[model samples]
Target chain A: MILKSLIFINGFALFIGFLILFLDKVISRYGTVTITLNSEKEFKAEGGKSLLRVLFENKYFIPSACGGKGTCGYCKLVVSEGGGEALPTESLVLTPKEIRQGYRMSCQLKVRSDMAIYIPPEYLEIKEYTGEIVSTELVTSDIREIKIKLVEPESISFKPGQYVQIRFDVDGDFDYRAYSVASHPDTQGEIEINVKLIPEGLGSTYLHALRPGDTVYFSGPYGDFFLNTDSKRKIVCCAGGVGLAPLKAIARYWLTHASNREIEFYFGSRTTKDLYDHSMFEEMAGKSPNFKYFPALSDEDPEWDGERGFIHTIIDRHLEGGYKAEAYLCGPPIMIDAVTDVLLSKGVPQERILYDKF
Target chain B: MNLALILFASIITSNIALTYFLGMCPFVSISKNIRVASGMGIAVTIVMTVTASANWLILNKVLIPMGLQYLQFLVFIITIATLVQIIEIFLDRFSPALYHAFGIFLPLITVNCAILGVSLFAMLRVYTFWQTVAFAFGSGIGWFLAIIAIGGLRKKLMFADPPENFGAAGITAILAGIMALAFIGFTGIASL
Candidate 1:
């Protein structure tokens, strides 16, 4: 008789649980605004939901390095109207120039009423991919080479120099970090990413913990760092540490198809131990007569006999006759700034240099 | 024992934000301006009241009987999160003006420790239903009052010359410490 009563009470409690959850859903369903994005797309979003969340749910991608935390200041969009007051969160991230141009942080702006927003033309074409980790290898003591087999899309079409945002589920929250796609665009079903373990970074921490056969959430073919096909100028590629990600991607593309340009890649490192995939670059140099690889070490052992000095010094010595060539630099802010000064002094136009600094 | 004493004690002696240091993030960030701070203060007050009452019902009626008392923290957090989401939706639909005023701060209230702190305190004290409601409402007003007073002081300080090292958070922290000390004077009043 006691067991029967206990069973009845448990059943009643379960019913109450369902009731509460159901009521919550019912209450949430009452209020919401319909948003029409870019004129062609339509989504029924919960009214007062942030524009970023709405767009994300509708498969419209906006670049947000901070994963809706409103910290990185990357998610910006042009809203024609219907976005309420400029939020404090958005104000912290926007510049006076951006404020005048109607650029608002999409994550901070909520849709109180029906709204229209114009996303960048490039963001519309970005795709999300599900890929399986096929291999994981250590590139440096702290950096890892993660190669994924594209599961759903079968293949991705992207410029050789672009980057993708890798998303990881950490502590019940989704965190995203961007990494340059290192594999050639021509490679089907396989995507390669070189990640340096950021000391306490959410994505890097998870990437460091991951092993082969893990499924990871990644989206992209974003960023505009690809090589300019119109220029026949000599190319000076400067890379430091994991900045090798995009440089390697561009090099893979250049080796496979584009053979006419003169390319000299100057890779810088703190010590000889920092170098990875040296044989791969040497193989590429052997295959392409126009390509040359210069691995410069800032501190070389006594037994080492390669170029020793800062990368800027090496470029200064070898890049004679001023900058008649386009420059692509990817490194720490200090290195990028120092190299920019050197390259500009050598006559490389500021507009011709493309770079991304963390 | 009565509403007036409860109000007085809550607003002065035991402010959730100033006394317990709950909801300090929004207190510091939103307190830069008086107008916005007042809006956020009011929003927090309303949400705290509603969340406390709802959580009391769930705790007394559901969890206690099922021997699920250990789930209090998790249940309270999820309840607050879901309640904030629901309230945000309702506010956007019914009153766009108020929604615009409180829109930015409403979502952040989910993580605001004051709301959770009040709910947990109410449960810990095991207040009667009516007492729970009164305590919740009183605590909300206390938080509102503290933030508004600090906001006004900050606005005034903006024009005054502060010491070289006492700018921004330095001055705010000193002022907060002084205010907390002053609030101790109210402790002599009849306890709630």
Candidate 2:
């Protein structure tokens, strides 16, 4: 009886397994579907995957902040044909105007049939690069700067203020986090990024633990927050803490490319110890006739005697009324809002002010 | 055995959720609003009926003939899990709207004790094929009714202020107890 039961159970389990395999094969089969990108690129893909996965498999990576969970609203693409109506989850993240313009979250939309999608030109210009970490330095109590030397691609050319998305594994699932490049735009073969350690943050903790000689995979040069070299107006830069990264890049670019243009930088931190790269900017100010630097401390520092107060007050004091100034502000949201108000009231046009808020 | 009487008794008098309280996990957690509760109710009803009928066939046709009735628990659970998986794949391929509607709840149905309870009860009662199908379908409908009634009541209960310790789960348990008491009035309506 025991032998009979063993055989029966094992045979039944095998039969059920085969039945499941058969059902899965027959049901999920949808043949091949065509994916047309930007009316120019076309590829045939199997019909059971999401548009985001299909694009990723085909070497076109759409930035998905929530890793295709449809929460971050970053993996949006214009599906002009055959991608179906936006799902309830997608509609939650997409604006009504964006919906009207045929925008859909690629992660939430499946590719069951032929589809036509429009990708931004800049996204196509983005490339995947592998690199080795050359060094990592703690620039402040909470911030760490990592420098990576390009290995696969010999070098990279990107705008000074743009950012890169680094892909890493955390808890067995891949997470991608964007960090603005902090090195000079003209720097060859290597890129530097500053990361602030946020409590229990997946990306920040992963970044802060990196040591020299570690390999990293990241992709590239995203965001429209770069310097507008075409604008001849006086450049006004405002930074708070680690937000100084992209502004430092813009400052380096200004010193090299546009030394004749008038530029003023206002950096704010809670204490003197919170400040970094102060001497470099001061030296640049001393050397360039048209450049100025102002570093402010919000808290008391008995040993230091530089400018005291928030950066917004320093900007308000030095901002002249009759000047055409193009402002570049990067910092916390509150600091950006305060400085934008100061700049607007000081006669800078609203369109002339661009900011990247953390 | 009279099928109509068995169906009536299982639905009203011997209701699975109210009388036996076999599936309280989803009962308390998903009984928040009418729409979501009803969706879960429909999914549970369909899965319960199908799995119970399948379990009945396996118990009577194979286990009884082979005298391997001791393996009923393991076999019943495997059948229910595999059937739910097949159903999900079927829905995803042919009816994507239904697939999206069921969404996460389809996989969740595999673990629902109410589904396993129907199969076990049918086996314990020595139910024939048609009788087991009737009992399972009626039990699903009964559970559907119970959850919808509580969902409506909880929507109204949100407006009234309650004691601090009587939080959401506590209040749901008290309400379920009261509902079970109310169902006791239907005890003599029918019997298997």
Candidate 3:
């Protein structure tokens, strides 16, 4: 009985496995589809894999913040032909205009047969860089600032405020997380990013655990959150928590290069210690004659007497007199919403008030 | 069990989700959206019927006579996993539209404890072949009803103001509890 059962289980498992293999060979087979990319590149891929996985395996750096999960909607590609109709899930992420233009979330869309997908020229320019952790310091109680020096394909040129998707776990499967470049844009071989440790974020935990000399792999230069150099109005910048990263990049570039003296930076924190690198702004202020820094504390603080309320309240109080300024706000949703209302009420045009929610 | 009684009991009193809470992962996660939740419900129902019947065959034909019933868990899982893969491939070939609609959920259905639980229950009762089929079919429909009900509730929950402690996942969990409690009212009506 034991011998018969052992054979039964093993034989049944084998039969089922073979059945699955045979069906795949017959009905399910699409005979390895060819993937045409941007009218320039061509690659052959198995029919059933997601377009996002196919593109990733082919080393095309299409940024997906959610790691091929459909939620992020970052890995969008235009399928000119051969890809099927918009899936119900794909429609959730894409706008009507985008759908009409053949835009679909690559992660959710499967490549069944011969297909042509368009990767934006900008995405094609994004490349993976290997770097060593040159410097790391605790900028605040929770936020750590780290600098990376590129090893191969030495230097990178990304516009200020653009981010890079850093990947780790060299020995095993890699995990990726996006971090905005905080270092100056003109820096030759090095880049810096500020990371605030969340309660238990995998990305933040991995980044915070890194020490000097650790090798890191990252792809750049992603995001549309760079400085609009053509706007000549007064720049009103607001930053809360680690949302200061891209703003710092924009500030550093504007301070060094631009001739405008109309830059105002408002750093918001609940109390004194929550303000990461407070003195760094003061030092920058000392360097420039026209630059002003307003560090606002929201909750009750025995040490700080200046700017008692939230950043928006301070803006509301100070903006009694008319001033035409373009606002750049980056912070939590509450701060962004409140500050946006304040800025809009003070006559900052809706288009002129740009923000990145943390 | 009488066919009508099994159908009624499985759907209300002995609901796979509300009574057993066997597939809470998908129930709590996928119940967030009504459309996807219904889609998941239908897919799970079909997969459960297929897997349960297949597992019954394995239980009676392979495990019982050989005294290898101890391997129920492993064998059941093998049957489920293989069936899901085969269904996925078959659907991909013939019903491309249905494949896309239900394909993602096929892999998820393999892990659903409800599918395995129903199979085990059918075996424990020493059900005859047709009786086992009826029980599996009933269980699948029961799961579908429970999930779709929860999905409908959660659809309304999207607009409802959640409590302070109820983060998105927390809200779904609390709803699951409430749904289970509501399902208890049916126990007095049907003795399964």
Candidate achieving the largest DockQ: 2
Stretches of model 2 off by over 4 angstroms after superposition? A1-30, A65-69, A129-155, A167-176, A187-190, A195-218, A232-242, A258-276, A285-358, B20-33, B54-90, B107-113, B148-187
- Put down candidate 2 lDDT per residue, A1-358, tens digits, no spaces: 8898899899999999999999999888988999898999899999888898888767787866456778767789999998767777887999999999999999999888899999998788878899999999998899898999999886888897888888888787576777889899899599999999999988889888889999999888777788998878899999999999999999999999998899998999998778988889999999997998989999999977988998999998887752589899999889999999999889899988988877
lDDT on C-alpha atoms for all candidate structures: 0.81, 0.88, 0.83
Tens digits of per-residue lDDT, candidate 2, B1-192, equal: 799988988888888898899788888998997888998889888999999999998888899899999999889989999999998989888878877777788899899899999999898888889999999999999999999998998898878767869999899889989998888787877765
- Among the numbered candidates, top lDDT falls to 2
Q: Which stretches of candidate 3 lie over 4 Å from their true place?
A: A1-32, A46-49, A287-289, A320-323, B1-45, B66-96, B103-192
Whose TM-score is higher: candidate 1's or candidate 2's?
2
Quality of candidate 3 docking, DockQ: 0.46
Two-chain DockQ for each candidate model: 0.16, 0.47, 0.46
Which CAPRI quality tier does the interface of model 3 achieve?
acceptable
lDDT of 1 by residue, A98-147 (tens): 87778888988766678878888889888888898999998788889999
Q: Which docking category, incorrect, acceptable, medium or high, applies to candidate 2?
A: acceptable
